[model samples]
Target: MGLVVSHLSIDCTDPNALAGWWAEVLGWERAWDEDPDDDEVGIRAADRSAEWLFLKVPEAKAVKNRLHPDLRPPDGSDQATELARLLALGATPVDIGQGPEVLWHVLADPEGNEFCLLLRTPAQVRADGD
Candidate 1:
């Protein structure tokens, strides 16, 4: 059988805070009890289909990420509304040479890990045959 993918892991300076921030952004919940001094923290989707683990690291992020998540809005939400909500939740825009006309908005979490907010919702994609 082919290998099954599990959780995505991220290295950060403060696991608890970063994990909490991501949980808020994705509407997920903590996977386990939070310990302020712990070196790792995790959050998972409500259905447990997706998960991300944050690992404590001594060094700060020094460059753009080689890998990052591209988020699309869920069925009931549109890109603009989701973008505003993400900004209000402490996400900052990042310009990684994507240029002005690109279909996605690059943004960084509290710890500078870059991710993209894509232009279309799932429903839009379905309707447009994209």
Candidate 2:
């Protein structure tokens, strides 16, 4: 009676380069290869905890992303700690019109896909835009 997400797929200009960037972020390894002759990469979280797949696409991104993922440190961890870690790993800050008081920091990968670092768990996100 419940639908579960098996994996998250992203379209990128370079699969291998994007996959490598994500692998460093999630501490994941290559899970599988979708094609041998073509470039499609699957990067899975360490211990197979989750999956994120990157596929090579021809079209360039023209507008903001409609959906994005938020990465949060495990329970009891603080956002600043994880933010520093991710920045050191090559993620750059993205100006998404959010203010300093916001609970999440927007960042872009090497290829410009926008993702966020959340200060709280999904259930703890403030409902009101206060």
Candidate 3:
């Protein structure tokens, strides 16, 4: 069988708060429930085509995320716009070993999850030294 990505799960200190932060960042909406459980919260893409889940963990975040999500704007759009938007959503800038020549900017979520903003499109990611 082949594998396909379904959803991404993140562990955080506050599920509701992080979920809300992501919702604003992605322009998604939190799914409705009478009372969201203490351990989990979720946000669905505004069109309902994708979902992201956040789960509460007892320990503090201690290291960089080994895996990170890369976000890009549609073709013909510049990365500057996307960067500004993300910063407005509460993402903080991070150095993360990237040099000035790097094509992506490393950033941390409100809860310190490391993610990147890529200058290239998915179709162009196979090149070297990206």
Candidate 4:
């Protein structure tokens, strides 16, 4: 049998809060089994398809993240609107050496982990028109 990616994991100072923030951002729900005081917390899509696991770590973030989630605009919104909404949710813009021609916005979560927000694809733009 082949392996499949069941979840994406994030390491952070506060797993519970990070998990909650991500859940709000993605419109996903917390995995009912997780507790606010747990070192590990999980969130997943309504269908439980995109599972995300957040783990607490002892060391603070010292450098750039090696891996991070790249978020895409949902069905009806455009990238700029989504970016503004995320900023309101406490995501701050981060400079990761992206040039003027770069097609995505680099942002950091409250704990300073870097992630990208890509511009909407053609299909997503079409969805906006619908």
Candidate 5:
């Protein structure tokens, strides 16, 4: 049998708070049935791609993230629009030496975790059967 991913986990200083922020950003809901002050929190996608598991850790992020999620705009939306909305949700632009040569916008979540807001390519749109 092939291996399957149960969830994507993130280590943070505050699990509940970070989960809340991501939930708002991704339109996901809390999947954990724990107290508001729990050291671990979960956020799940409506389509069930995979849930995000956030666990509280004592250490802070000190370097660039090796693995980051790249988000594509929904069928009806564009990158610029989504980027603006994410900015309103506390995402900040991060310069990680990806200058003008790159097409993706590098942004960091509230916890300084780097993620990319990718430009939707024709392939993705076509694959969506648009």
Candidate 6:
């Protein structure tokens, strides 16, 4: 049988904090039995099919992420609304040479991990016949 995909791990200075931040961003919850001071922390997706694991590391993030998550707004939410909300939640805009004309916005979390907010929500994509 083929191997199954598990969690996506991220290295950060403070796993608990970063994981909490991401949980807020994704509307996920902290994994069961994970404490605020743990060196490794995790958040589970609403449906529990996916997880993001965060591990503590000594060095700060020094370079752009080679692998990053691309996020889409949920139903009833559009890209501009989501961008505004993320900015309010402490996510900052990032410039990764994705010039002005691109359809998505690049953003960095509080710990400097880069992720993208795509231009269209799933509802929009469906409406556009994409």
List all candidate RMSDs to the true structure: 1.0, 4.2, 3.6, 3.1, 2.4, 1.4
lDDT of 3 by residue, 49-69 (tens): 788888899987899898888
Model 4 pairs whose backbones collide: none
What number of clashing residue pairs does each candidate have, in the order they appear? 0, 0, 0, 0, 0, 0
Q: Give the lowest summed-lDDT range of ten residues in model 2.
A: 121-130
Give lDDT tens digits, candidate 4, residues 18-112: 89898899999998676768998989999977898888999889899999888888867889998999999999999988877888999999999
User: Model 5, stretches more than 4 Å misplaced?
Assistant: 121-124, 127-130
Off by over 4 Å in 6: 127-130
Candidate 6 per-residue lDDT, tens place, 27-120, comes to: 9998867676788898999899899999998999999999999999999888999999999999999999999999999999999999999988
Kindly provide the TM-score of model 3 when superposed on the true structure, using C-alpha atoms: 0.80
Best-performing candidate as measured by TM-score: 1
- The sequence of per-residue lDDT tens digits that candidate 2 reaches over residues 56-94 is 889866667889888877555678987998899888998
Which candidate ranks first by lDDT, i.e. highest?
1
Better TM-score candidate (2, 5) = 5
Model 2 residue 26 distance off true place after TM-score fit, in angstroms: 0.9
Per-residue lDDT of model 1, residues 1-130, tens digit only: 9987799999999999999999999999999999999898999999999999999999999999999999999888988999999999999999999999998999999999999999888889999999
- Estimate the TM-score for candidate 5: 0.90
Pull out the clashing pairs in model 5: none
lDDT of each: 0.95, 0.81, 0.81, 0.88, 0.91, 0.93
The C-alpha stretches of model 2 lying farther than 4 A from their native spots are 33-38, 75-77, 121-130
RMSD of 6: 1.4
Off by over 4 Å in 1: none
Q: What is the lDDT of residue 47 in candidate 6?
A: 92
